[model samples]
Target: MSVSKLAQERLGDYILKYCLLFEINIFYFTFHTTELRSKHSTKYFLLCCFQTCFHALCRKFPPSVNYRKRFLTELIRRQETVDHAPLDELYDALADVVGAEEKSECYKSYLLPCGDTVSLLENVALISEGTTGLVTWEAALYLAEWALDHQQVFTGRTILELGSGVGFTGITICRSCSPKKFIFSDCHTTVLEKLRDNVQLNGLTEKMSPAVSVEELDWMTVTKEQIKEMEVNTVIAADVVYHPDIVESLVKLLSKILSGSAEGAPKILICSTIRNSETYSGFKQQLEAAGISHHVITGPVRKVFPYNRDSFIEMITLYK
Candidate 1:
């Protein structure tokens, strides 16, 4: 059910008061936000109680069926407010990119596809929003785009994306050129819903239809079936280099997925920002030492997100 603005405002404000009063750490988020440090505050104090409560409520409640209107409103508002973008705007932007010239359409602000059924197809969509777990499209696009530049090399190739958050990078290429079979991998089942929704949001069913195949390829828990199912010829990862501790393990997972190529040697494209630069470096060195070959197209954009001038995304295209 839809929460009215009046009720939401009241509940949100009330929740904010109670939570912030209950936990004073929220003010720190507002105060510390200007430091150029990107820290997400899930637990805000009383003043931000609604934010937390809202998320918790949504999680408790299944995906809201009545959110179409709300999301439509949000999508429009987001496109207009990109200079001062909100989470919704990023999602709309990610959903709006179209391929094949004028052959694309959007339902409201989201792209509309030919059908609801999904199969392995490589299409590209804008990846925006996602400031949480997955790599931000703002940081991941450069790498995906680079792969697009080489699209002729891998057209109709089987592709896979691990930890595909909101799926901007993967969807974008799929729309640009039709790939034979495609797989989208993510660790979180919740975000995968959005990822599937996003694939449909872009008019890509005829181009690269949705495939039921979302695998939980946690870097630490990757399995052979996951790799076999993925069977991707080209793999791309973006903004995943921030977690230094798992760099080696993450690369290992990539190794497993990419190891199946018998013909032309598999290729992998990775773009990441260095929250854990030293560890990321270690991962890179290890990948190189393995006889696996790769080309580093770009590296972390040091400025800030979206607005970072001279901020280049880190990219690595690996082959074995």
Candidate 2:
């Protein structure tokens, strides 16, 4: 049976989202007979899904073994509902995962709209090594979507990212937006180490155009000289406004970077998840007190990465 255009689109989306390890509930696999006529069509769809996910598991930078096991288990559980036995390949993949030792690190790959993939080696835990920078945050995904939509802002421009955890947004911009230079900055030792590995994993080393570099930048201790030396035309950050204390230092850092620029102040774009209302409000107030003007900018037109859609994330633009 031929699948409708809508069904084909939905199947493609499901397959890509699964490969990226997006949160797939059991309900997603509950296929209706009316929608897909004939057992053959249903089986074809299931095979396509499993093959894409299996390829992701065997990729050079694969997801964690635990994650792969969970995915395979879900697919196997759905096989009974379809009145069909699980594919032998699916069982084999699960066996491999079960036999392998689990690691603290894993890889998450995002397929960009430009047909390029941004893969990063990230910590499996939400917070690791006394810092949350070891993994990509929701706000980083939000900001990356926005940047891809506004490619002109970064194209041919030198960009500096503050608190660039795991280098997701920066790498995405460098690959898709065609930035002249991309610098990823963070203070945590473990975060920086993993960030550099991710950059190389994505093949964004210095040898490539839009020269990519990782720097250790502590917002509290960063100086005007340091910001000036970077000579960036644009400054961006994501998920760096979690605490009230950091608000003061971030505002000061933005002020220094803007003032020290020779070819006029570099544009500042900051994206943050509104986990705490008071903390977010304090960020804006600090920007005002420091003579920096900020306005809430529009979000991305579409999402290219998987993230918590329910979370409230805001993107703001700062200027002198």
Cα lDDT listed for each candidate: 0.49, 0.81
Q: Which residue runs does candidate 2 get wrong by more than 4 Å?
A: 1-13, 23-37, 41-46, 56-58
| TM-scores of the candidates in the order shown | 0.52, 0.90
Candidate 2 residues 34-63, lDDT tens each?
A: 554456555554555554555544366677
Best by TM-score: 2
Find the 10 residues in a row with the least total lDDT in model 2: 18-27
Model 1, 102-161: lDDT tens digits are 211121111113212112221222332333433234555465445555667457787777
Kindly provide the TM-score of model 2 when superposed on the true structure, using C-alpha atoms: 0.90
The numbered model that scores best in lDDT is: 2
